[model samples]
Target: MGITDFFSDVWDTFAHPSPDAEAPKGGSSTETPAAGTPEESSEEAEVNKQDAVKSDESQQEQGHIPSDDAEEEEEEEEETVDPKDKLEADCQESKACAPAKHHYDECAERVMGQIENDGKAKEDCVEEFFHLAHCATQCAAKPLFSQLK
Candidate 1:
């Protein structure tokens, strides 16, 4: 499931716990059923337990371990998606901070030009840089904060 779905499920579990659930707080439906239902004989229960043990033993003997690819995929997905980068890109693409970005770029270019043409030390564009950063931060803050824990 996606992050949104996961959070939604968590919210739903707390907000609308099933009345028939054994515990005060409801649990996931994915849990295994309780053992020894009415239809199961004692002999059958014993046989089932033995079968389960044998299956486990055979798996261990064969070195057959379950893959955690799903977990790995989830981790990879999170690692690949940098919310800050995404937010910054969004701000740039939307041109919400265009004026500030343009000013910063102009200041940088002017500083570089002076250094190259006049053989002078490069001038700092701290003010312009901060102005651009502040604009981008303003655009990024809401979405970026929402994505983070």
Candidate 2:
């Protein structure tokens, strides 16, 4: 038997505590049950067959898919938008952090210009970047977090 079947058999042994389940003479614990017994009954087989037929019938009734647009829409609907994205979008839309953002952009441009001209940047934009982040976070935190669970 498979590992799952063996585990289930072990679980059944412990749950029921049957006396017939004696330790094997020479074989290991991973041994399968004797081959004479059937794994599933005829009734069980018939029920499984019926279920498969019903599933096929349901698919047939649904008919052909029109286009991939429906699938794309479903995927978009299913996706959970991140809260950070909402905060960033709100910050951009509100323009409350515009001054800080402009300063950061100027610092970044200066660094890039230095690198292009001299093959090295005189200063990193960490201070300006942190100022911009602080402004954005302060402006966006209340509205964004209040809506989240």
Q: In terms of TM-score, which candidate is strongest? A: 2
lDDT of 2: 0.79
Instruction: Give candidate 2 regions above 4 Å deviation.
Output: 1-77
lDDT of 1: 0.80
Q: How would you encode candidate 2's per-residue C-alpha lDDT over 1-149 as one tens digit per residue? A: 89999999899978985677778578543344455656656777899999999887877689643358877887778667788767875785467888888888899999999999999999999998888778777877787778875
**What digit string (tens of lDDT, one per residue) describes model 1 on residues 39-149?**
665777899999999999999788785559856776777446677877876786467888888888889899889989998846879998888778878899998888885
Backbone collisions counted per model: 0, 0
Structure candidate 1, residue pairs in collision = none
